[model samples]
Target chain A: MARTADVDDLVARARKGEPRAVARLITLIENASPQLREVMAALNPLAGRARVIGLTGAPGVGKSTSTNALVRAFRRQDLRVGVLAVDPSSPFTGGALLGDRVRMQDHASDAGVFIRSMASRGHLGGLAWAAPQAIRVLDAAGCDVVLVETVGVGQAEVEIASLADSTIVLVSPGMGDSIQAAKAGILEIADVFVVNKADRDGAQQTVRDLRNMIALAAPEGWKPPIVPTVAVKDEGVADVVQKLDEHLAWMEDSGELNRRRRARARDEIEAIAVTALRERMGDLHGHQRLDVLAEKVLDGSCDPYAAADELVEGLTESG
Target chain B: MARTADVDDLVARARKGEPRAVARLITLIENASPQLREVMAALNPLAGRARVIGLTGAPGVGKSTSTNALVRAFRRQDLRVGVLAVDPSSPFTGGALLGDRVRMQDHASDAGVFIRSMASRGHLGGLAWAAPQAIRVLDAAGCDVVLVETVGVGQAEVEIASLADSTIVLVSPGMGDSIQAAKAGILEIADVFVVNKADRDGAQQTVRDLRNMIALAAPEGWKPPIVPTVAVKDEGVADVVQKLDEHLAWMEDSGELNRRRRARARDEIEAIAVTALRERMGDLHGHQRLDVLAEKVLDGSCDPYAAADELVEGLTESG
Candidate 1:
């Protein structure tokens, strides 16, 4: 049987760079185990040490192709790379889960690259189960670069872009919806913008329109660069990578890096707290007579606010 | 000065179908006064009587245009229409907020049509501070049909969509991305889908791809129909309305309407409880010498989770 390690052992093994252990750890966290946040807290100090790059856009912006190409680019520098492509399970085919394995064929034998596809079941706002834990695993695996390829966002994808050290929003020519992106959170979230499919005729116009839109939307001094690429051919991958370096440098110089990282940490903490509270609601209720109180509040018998007030009041009064 | 009415008067005025009173009541609830939820409770029975339709998509998909066209179609039947447009500001705005206001000038003088733009002000999931109250106001305002126009959703928008009787996801014809909607929650949240700008050449392909995708993605029994339209010309608006009617019939025919509505109401009650708990966080901490507890938690001398437990435990132990 595959090793079924304890949570602490899993964390230790993951920290020591065991991919299997890391995967299990991610599953445990994503499933909201009773001890998940405690495990996360144990791993907290070790997190945020890795560079996370988020790739997102409407579907068909060549996000997966771009991710594959970027993996090659990073490997060319002899850097260990980790790829995470989130594929949602189809509702039909009796809950057919789209495994990313078929899409990332080349990386299977390459020990230097670890590619995992996640399912965003119950995923909201780009927040998927196990995502944070998965990110941590990659970080612990000592991967210098982690490329997160999302399930492509409709409007909710903003959540994915916000978590990355640098976010590249992919677009293409002839889509004719390039202008619409400026109005979406796409412009606000991108550290670098990529207009893929540079071979298309209207690509230049799309780039121009984007630059103009960014100019209008960008606060007077902050302008994110727009680059064109044919992701399938890996054309302009180097340029895209270089632009990312520039964006990171700019964020650091502008003191935005720490600010953003701190904000992300806070969001993580809050998300965990909220999730934790909900998870422990049953446990918490057992320690008190909450069910008794809640019933009274529900049937037009008493004020809910006052009942809630009594819960706290009773504690202070009796504790 | 605006007339300041109590919650009861406001509810009564709104129930009698006065737009001004409805707007005022919404303003009150959003402001988060002492009696907001109580007022919402009072108004709850009046809601769900109207057909609540939710419209969402990427920004600038002409969602508002489609909404307007649909609203006009409903109004032609002499049905009173109420629209809740979720704006970026809770009650104030500048720049694009102004642009948003400008685009919505057609019904500026219509009495039968009541329009209110709610600003969420970064409250994720796109809910206005006083949305439930606003919803009640619109419900009490005697609108036969109420359309909820989202600013854009990340996660909360998806959650909000569940509250609607019908949800139409609008998309443009020439999206660079292949997936009509990201395989995110939105893929499943939509009831009826529309690919706007049918005049565009790729519109048919977009619709076809969407139909094929939905056919593959939708669960066994609930396949949403995809409609193509030039919303600006009002082309296919009536068909869209007819499809919406058909969807309602399907829901009732399938025996899912009452179940879904009950579930949504239960969700509302649960959400209210959660929001109430958060709102009362300060109240729970009132004059309790919490700064020391907070300092200790921040300083890492005391665990944050432990501190919260201490508070909750202390509250109940006294009882």
Candidate 2:
């Protein structure tokens, strides 16, 4: 089959500030495909230009409201903002929820704002195969800040942290998961904590719980600030954004951003490597090499490691 | 440095039914090792022989206690059993603790029962890595059953379910994580559900809740029995054992045992093929290749998937 067109044209259009083209590029590769290869190739150059932040929590924790408010907040400052909300865990809808686009309509007319929902059907890891491409597309579009809001923690969304420069864990007051901030399985990955929906009754206690947990768990001198906000009212959101800037500033000041980005680069490399290796298991099968070696190892004719090493050497040398 | 003879000897001794040998083998590979290649080779033939089962939940959810009791239950029926208790999530003693042998002393003296604690240091998937080898040792040692216990939703433990013939998800009442059982990302993987510490309040409620949820969610026919058990007091351990035996029997009678085992063999083959690729990666200036690729992809000079596909094709074709 002929290779699909690279995302370069869409990127070119998007970079010209065409919102529809940008959204189309993201939509085209929102899942895994042969075309994702071309898109990712085109997208990589555009990354590292935007400050990418990730927001993640349980469903109905007001992540959409929080994300919408944040997008609006960034727009007020005349920044080109991109909002990519992840809804992968809701098994039925994939990750591209039409309702998400509806909620995002508040920013529809703003040429500075772009929103996309990444689907997780065949690719459960957020965008699965397409996420890195979408992020690249947005970056090329000159979005100064890109915010990714994952509706919940799943194998895919959690891995998103490895790619994010900064991660904000969204929690609510009455959710009974306050102390869970420490043991939320992904707490160790958070850079900032947002106590969304603080209008609820347990807001203060939730803040206290978060404070105590963060105080107890964070490495000495690496305290992550807990910002309380009623996102629906747009109250305290600017403060939340202010804290986000402070945290990013601290990451830069401490030389952590470069280190974290280096690690993120390494992780993406490994993930890609593993994926590629899985796709190429047949070369070892030709010449009846592995089958013979496997039989030998299975029967103790040769030591397993020696036989394995010999097989690799044989395949490589023969190659 | 020469590869350790200790790993090879310990694995052999463990396969020969030596408890101390099994314990030592578990401890040696529990940490990151350049020797994982040699050890895994030594372990390959011996793997895929035992019936591996995984149990997971929140901390203090009594996984160890339940595992200990389950082993005793198997012993009661004269079934030779091997228990691989995974304690690697956190350092019970700073990232390495192989103390389950001492804690499960009752079955320690019985040659038919081999218990080992796994401590994973750096390998993200080491839980599955160590497990298949350990289970192999037990299987070749003439063991009829092997149980692996882990906590929370982790990638390492999740791999166990794929390797195991049947998987059990262990949960307790008070933690209120039965909802976790419903949302327990691994619920789909469980063949049996055990509500441990059933003597506690809300045991019935936990069972009722799990059953209702299962009835709603389980496929048309399969409804995993949520066996209520006091694993500590041996209260419902017999029923669990009975259920396990019935499940195994059903599998054998229904031709599922052979079919599943054959599927596992294919997985074993695929896993070994991937491992072979990784070993080859170790030999190349892999770091150099990745760096070059990163630079190319960053500037959009090359696509990542194509680069990745090229990497794999180069290794296998040129190896």
Point to the candidate with the largest lDDT: 2
Candidate 1 local lDDT, residue A295: 50
Over B1-319, each residue of candidate 1 has an lDDT whose tens digit, in order, gives: 2332566777787788887777666666445556665666566556656788888876567888988898889989999888877643232423334644665587776678887776554443235234544665686678888898875534445655766888888888775454425543566888888889989888888888777777667566667888888899999888889889998898889877765664454334334444554444434547242344444443445543455555444334433
Q: Looking at candidate 2, what is the lDDT of residue A212?
A: 76
Tens digits of per-residue lDDT for model 1, A74-138 = 88988888886654322221122234556557676676787776654553212623465567668
Taken over the whole model, the C-alpha lDDT of each candidate is: 0.65, 0.66
Model 2: pairs clashing at backbone N, Cα or C within 3 Å: A315-B319, A316-B319, B91-B95, B180-B184
For candidate 2, what is the DockQ-based docking class?
Answer: acceptable
Give the local distance difference test score of model 2: 0.66
Q: Model 2 over residues B233-293: C-alpha lDDT tens digits?
A: 9888888877777777877787766655544444444444456665555445756666666
**Candidate 1 local lDDT, residue A204:** 90
